[model samples]
Target: MAALQIRQDYSAPDLRQRAARERDTRASLRLLAIANALEGMPRAEAAGLAGIKCQALHDAIQRFNAEGPDGLHDRHRSGRPEQLSPGQQAALKAHILHGPEPERDGVSAWHLVDLCEYVERTYGDSEWGLSGPLKRLNLSRQKTRPSHSNGHPAAQAAFKKGAAVTAAEPRGTAS
Candidate 1:
């Protein structure tokens, strides 16, 4: 197979330096390394230097030639679309800010399941979970700390005030 000629616009050392300074993803660095190796070496050797297969080296070269340095970076991909519209999101945020009341909403606190039901009933059918909405709204659920069942509030306050309370068995007797 005929060896593909690499463009001589930049030297291998220059490419290597640029690759070192590249702040993007690791794939870009690998592409730069491959481009540098291809400057003088054969496809197989260049691929080895870049720790990629020959096919990948060929693809990288084509990308580099067509789009220059920018082509070496990762391509943007569109992920799953959001279920809630802008207005719906705004409404949800407003509802969350209003908070829940025991007499009105019939709950002391808003739970994930309760929020999910509320969204489904109020906004429409939404598969969106609580976590995503909570993150987007920058809201967090308040949690209550566990307290001892037998703890006495008045006795605790007295202890804090330096009240001298004697032990049940007294300090001197072991029995």
Candidate 2:
């Protein structure tokens, strides 16, 4: 069987320059390295210099031959689709930003679990997890103790005075 060879080949220096300039991805560089090697060396040696398997080099060479530099790019992978659409995500963000109504939202503040449940009920995508949806909505967990409408300023001052006294007291039989 004949070894695969690069066609419409650029010179080694040209390939190097093109590889670096065409795209900045690792895949592109690797492809360019293989192409560069094939310019002056054999297929197996080219693959070795590129640190890829011969089969991979062959495939890349085929792609390069067919589509030039563009074929060397990483192909798009069909990842999991968004559980919520753009409008739905916007609505969710607004819902969070508007703040949860204690009586209406059934909770004082947003909890991830509660948010997940809300998403399930509101958007019908129960698969929505904490991090992904929160990131998508540009939301983060804010740690804040709820302030009471009738919080006692006097009591707080008294507590601070007592704390200062305690802190000032000599420890372990002074001097």
Candidate 3:
């Protein structure tokens, strides 16, 4: 196989300077490797000094030749596609924010299990699949503590006032 040639436009010193200024460790390594290659070091030795494989150095060289210094940096990777469409996600977000209808949803508040089931029934997706979308939407699994149905604010305030009064009153010594 023919040895890949390092671009002559960028000198070894220039590449070293760029490597020193680079924040990304991987990109810096690639720059260093190219610099070593530019200085007449063998491909395998150059890649080893950069803590990378010869193949990686070759790939970096190709990128550098094609796009110059900018090409040495990693390409933006588009990860796995979203399961739900934008409209569907928006609907889900709105549904979550508006809250579950007690009559229709049969729940006073939303829970992960409940939401999972709702997603399955409404979107035809599995119950397990809602977690990732919910996370992406920044919806937390944690729910607010439920208030007691029988609790009265007035009664609780009165009890607290009475307790405070009792606590403030000094106890008399036994005769």
Query: What lDDT does the true structure give each of the candidates?
Result: 0.73, 0.74, 0.89
Pairs of colliding residues, candidate 1: none
* TM-scores of all predicted structures: 0.64, 0.65, 0.75
Cα RMSD for candidates in order:
5.5, 5.2, 4.4
Q: Locate the minimum summed-lDDT window of 10 residues in model 1.
A: 25-34
lDDT of 2 by residue, 84-174 (tens): 8889888888998888899988998888888888888887788546677677667878767777899899877877744555455677777
The whole-model C-alpha lDDT of candidate 1 against the native structure comes to 0.73
Off by over 4 Å in 2: 1-5, 17-40, 73-78, 145-175
Per-residue C-alpha lDDT of model 1 across residues 15-131, encoded as one tens digit per residue = 777777788745655666566565667777877766778787787777777776667887889877777887887888788778887887778778878888888888677655678
lDDT agreement of model 2 with the native: 0.74
TM-score of candidate 3 versus the correct structure, residues matched by position: 0.75
| Highest lDDT model number | 3
Best by the TM-score measure: 3
Q: Poorest 10 consecutive residues of model 3 by lDDT?
A: 161-170
Q: What is the lDDT of residue 111 in candidate 1?
A: 84
Candidate 1 scores a C-alpha RMSD against the true structure in Å of 5.5
